[model samples]
Target chain A: MSAAPPVIDRLRARIGTPGPPTTAVVEAGHLKAFAEAIGDSYPRWLTEAPPTFLVALAPVTAHLPEAEEYGKGWLNGGNRFEYLEPVKVGDAITAIGKLVDVYEKTGSSGNLLFIIFETEYFNRHGRTVARLRGTAIRR
Target chain B: MNIEPGHELPDLIKHPTTRQLVQYAGAQGDFYEIHYDQEFARSVGLPGVILHGLLKAAFLGQLVTDWLGERGTLKSFEVSYRGIDVPGRPYRCRGRVTSVVGGRAELEVWGEDPEGNRTTVGTAVVELTA
Candidate 1:
């Protein structure tokens, strides 16, 4: 008998479907820890949210157990961030993530599954703050 | 500031460590074992707990921001991870102006491993403040 529909196909079914909106506040404490972790000592980072700080605000994509079954491990293929407005401390930001695309590619070692997800960030004022697109790979 | 193509941004070198990886994992709320758990990383065909692509993207972001430094605002930035890098090594960040037009500048940025491999590659677009 054929194996249960491959996990890649299972993941493909989720494209264009948004998960849920996650709301979070840009806290100063969290921003400090993130800059410290990155070892970036820029003084302004203490108050302003650095370029990647938004990812720290929320998960870009929901966890999919099915995708985990396909590969032994996961890799971050890439990420793109578009800033509409400055994200600063004390801004209440909400993030909504959705899978944009999923496909498979044959690499030298083996086959790889690529999942593309897009997330849009909005502040309490209802203005879009930033947009993030990331590619997660399973190999 | 006179911006021209081929101008290099000052380099920012980052020394990454396993401990920082854990710290970043907590800060980002990404608990994926591949980033902090060496055993799990090995199981997944990786050399060891590797740097997060977003972390590298952060480094490149700093590269542009440091150069722009109130001179402009970053409009967009992008990065693609081409290879895996482990901790305990210095990651070199570099960039150059690719073009500038109508008060907007485009830059080519990258992060290099010890051997000079462009493990993380990306670009940034910025609007220079008048």
Candidate 2:
């Protein structure tokens, strides 16, 4: 009945290593669109990024081709954001992410695979602006 | 900002539609079908298209910022999406000051479905101006 190695083990093998760093410059138009999408029209958002704007800059979860075979669907378990500086329009930011941990949990419905990952955001000055931790689940 | 331990932030209620979900999917660059494509979402075992967890986080973020105004800055904000939420229902975001010490304050935040279930629960920390 066993066919291949569990995806969790395959994913676990790459822990601590970060993927390529993605760099993007915050733009006023993007910020305005984001604010409008979320329906938050506070005038402040015209120049400054809102709290969850960082995720818009970079993906919260890394794309794992193997993990897709494990579950029929993906669910977002949660997210944590730490802001070290105010992200404003026109700031060039770079993000580097890595898989922190991977494990399997038995739930009421079925066995769920949990993938934990984190990303660090840095500004053009090389200063850390924020950190994000996320939990992506498959069942 | 009269942020006592029991201070309650004014709640923010959001009525998210499928159009907004599509908009968010584009804005966040998350083209995950579960959030936008109904057929694809169903194929993936979802009930239908669902709201992005980050969108709910944005709703909660607005809840905090709308209350704090210029009084403080958010240091850290976290949330765990405990249940699934569709786009048609109203999402109510609420939070209360859990603790206040000196220039720092902590609050518990959650987004409730129409049934009053706290589907998304989390916490946030803010540093107040002197």
Candidate 3:
């Protein structure tokens, strides 16, 4: 079998590169929209953000320029999330992210390249609201 | 809610449609074609337009929050995507309390298809008020 592609190495080299952070207010409308998008009709979201709503920060958290190139057929491996504080509507959120790691594995199916990254969301008062570590897989 | 070890939380079922995917794409800024365009999804070796993995994870998170009610806080949650699921099918999110110590409850949560195949598996911890 052939060796892993060179792109995998390029991704590995970018580890620790920080993505440009994004800032947005935790609006009730967006929260409601997200809840509705997931078919959730719970009333709690009217005033407070949903538990996983912070995943919307993907654009900021996953802003690596090289990531767009690997987007062709990549898959979301998964995510680990930790919630630190309740996000109320009208709070401002800033998401900062960086590429953590990249590696390859030769499994039963074939060769798979993985990218591991992390992001943190902070509130207006500079308190941590949530943290996320994610993985993207390319085969 | 009287959550105790071994108690199964209420199941949260979802019926995802392509329209919902579009709505999510707009709301979350994740306009990946594979999540809303059938042709693109097929080109990517998928059955059809698939739901966002984050959306599925959100459903599982909702399961915990809904069970915990207003007084609980989500401390941590994790999930690994095991399979791809297309829109237009019913997906179920369920969780069972593994332990309740002090003011925290630990749960084993997952999402599955109608066939009962696990697609997303993970665990979560919720801090409950005394």
Best by lDDT: 2
In candidate 2, what are the lDDT values of residues B13-92, reduced to their tens digit?
Answer: 99999999999988898998899888998897778999999999999999999998999999999999999899999999
Native contact recovery (fnat) for each candidate is 0.95, 0.90, 0.89
Lowest summed lDDT window (length 10), candidate 2 chain B: B1-10
lDDT of 3 by residue, A78-137 (tens): 999999988888988898888898887886777777888898999988999899899988
What TM-score is obtained for chain B in each of the predicted models? 0.98, 0.97, 0.96
Residue B97 lDDT in candidate 2: 97
Q: Which regions in candidate 2 have their CA more than 4 angstroms from the true location?
A: A1-4
Candidate 1 structure quality by residue, lDDT tens digits, B42-122: 887788899998888888998899999989999999999999889999999999999999999999999999999999999
- Clashing residue pairs, backbone N/CA/C < 3 A, model 2: none
Give residue B62's lDDT in candidate 2 (0 to 100): 96
Off by over 4 Å in 3: A1-5, A58-61, A65-72
Work out the TM-score per prediction. 0.97, 0.97, 0.92
Report the lDDT tens digits of candidate 3 across residue range B1-130: 5788999999999888889889988888888798988898899778988888999988898888878887778899999999988888999999999999999989999999999999999999998876
Q: DockQ scores for all the models shown?
A: 0.91, 0.91, 0.81
Q: What is the DockQ of candidate 1?
A: 0.91
In candidate 1, stretches whose alpha carbon ends up further than 4 angstroms from where it belongs are: A1-3
